[model samples]
Target: MSFDLGLQNTRALVTGGTKGTGAAIVDALANAGAQVIATARSIPADARKGVHFIAADVATSEGCAAVADGVLAAFGGVDIIVHVVGGSSAPGGGFAALNDEIWLRELNLNLMPAVRLDRALLPGMIAQGSGVIVHVTSIQRALPLPEATTAYAAAKAALSTYSKSLSKEVSPKGIRVVRVAPGWIETDAAVALAERLAEQARTDYDGGKKIIMDALGGIPLGRPAKPSEVADLIGFIVSPRAGAITGTEFVIDGGTIPTV
Candidate 1:
């Protein structure tokens, strides 16, 4: 199985790869012998081994151009691209509480990065005749919590639809486009967000988690998925083992989304 991965010397770019799930993905790819270029707004305090860090915010077109420039200049082009940059800091009062700026920020963070990156880098992939692209969306797109992430959910939903559409256009040209929807991933970001939620709900962290879980219909696994688990999945999807897999949305939500 490991041999089938065939990731040795593969060139990869992971957006938002400094911390949380992004860091995990970078580690997984690096461990598999891929040359990983990880991009984020800033450098991480504890960086991963054998992964090159490039500072950039993928949410902006300028940042997207910077990434594409760095990749092209360094490696000519990346063989695999995993988009892992996105989040919501909008107030928890639902749509009415969100202003235009917040909504636009959410869209820029969650949606435009993927769109802009693809537009800039896909030509190189097509020219090379093979590549892999993974867009990390969210379960919120499907099982939305409007009070907390209405704009974020909307943005991710757009990302998912865009990924599906792009996959059909590129798969035949030897480029694979896949979307991954992860729910409640265990990360430092998740912990910090939980702390805020705990404060707002006037409960302890565990109690706040319970409240959040209850609203989501509960994770049957009784816990969020580890970032490494999702990273491993992303690693596999981009590897030769999943070469036939394309244009699909894989949900690693710990069964939080109970839909079939």
Candidate 2:
């Protein structure tokens, strides 16, 4: 049996689509026959087929406007928006280690981009009276790791809450807003961190990865998730088949979160 999402001709804008989970989401949407407009700070040299690449930094209001304007001009209007542009620049150290500047940066990186994009594009979606918005949050919102990412956790918590509230207001108006929270995805960053930990601890990269997983209390599935796995869930949530699902968060963590 085939899992047909029936998203042909749908136009989607995926932020941070240059790499990692965002790239995977773009691929999934394209595979489902959606016309994908992917934005990032830089476009990859060997870009995927069936997806248009736009260069813009979503962390700034000007960048968000440029991307929205570009997409509107190219596609006329967008039917789906997947906000996957967020990360913590905070280095290791607890809350006190993060000063005011760092806190502001974290908030902007992890929260404001989505806010600005929604502000810019929601009017178009509202005018159409139908659309889907997916915000990629982190599992840190529920399981915060204060050792290095207190601000990141806080910002994602705010993003999740904002998504829920936004969904409530817009679901009655024919737009769906949802959140996806992923944990310890095995992306390029994860590999690099593991290698760095290995160098610091005088161990192999695989050994360092084991330490990291152990620190996460051991993933029940005995592994971190691939970016593609998270993308699969994203594709489902934004598809018409999931029309009844809105205003909620789906956690894809390989059972690492240890909660209901």
Candidate 3:
């Protein structure tokens, strides 16, 4: 079960590293002996030791470029870049619920950061002739939830397609690009949703959770995954041990995605 990454001295950049899955990935990379530069709009004051926190919003092209420059200046060049900074800004609505602004915001938040960062940093990785890139996508790309997150699903679908194309373009040059699609991660967001639903339904938090699960067709594992579980998959995918895993999607969803 040991991935045996031997990541000592390897430099990595993890976007959205202030909380949730991003924080978990940052911790995982640090534990594997990699020097990590974690970026977010604002870093937590009580952030863990050994991670260099950089204040930057990857949603902007300028911010992405600045982060890339800062990391290169500090670490010379990164061997791994984990794109974990995306999410939907749109509120709940079906197709008509999403306006142009919402569509643009979701695309920028969920898709553009990685595209911008790759444009800024992949050359360095290609020049070095070896690097790993992991894109954190969502299961929604395949299993679209139109009632609440149609725009989000569309944005993730674009991201998945872009990642696959980018991987094929870069893998021949000694850089590996892979994607991780997670389903129903147990994060603060989930907790908030549960609380909101509980109050609306006049039920307990667990009851709200059951309602959510039923909506998702019941997660086969009977629970959402922890952030650390997704992080573990990310850690392995970016390691040398997973060199042959480029241009593929790894779904860590507890069988929530029914398709083969």
Against the hidden reference, what TM-scores do the models get? 0.94, 0.96, 0.96
lDDT for 190 in candidate 3 is: 87
Model 3 lDDT per residue over 11-95, tens place:
9999999898999999999999999999999978899888898898777888888898899889888899999998776677688
Candidate 1 per-residue lDDT, tens place, 1-260, comes to 23657899999999989889998999999988999999998896788867878888787899999989998888888899999999988998877999999999999999999999999999999999999999999999998898879999999999999999999999999999999999988798878877888999899998777776788889998888899999999999999889899999999988998878
What lDDT score is found at residue 240 in candidate 1?
86
CA RMSD, predictions in order: 1.7, 1.2, 1.3
> Model 2, range 69-130, lDDT digits (tens) per residue?
99899998889999998898898879789999999898988899899989888988999999
Clashing residue pairs found in predicted model 3:
none
Clashes of 1: 0
Model 1: how far residue 9 lies from native, Å:
0.4
Off by over 4 Å in 3: 1-3
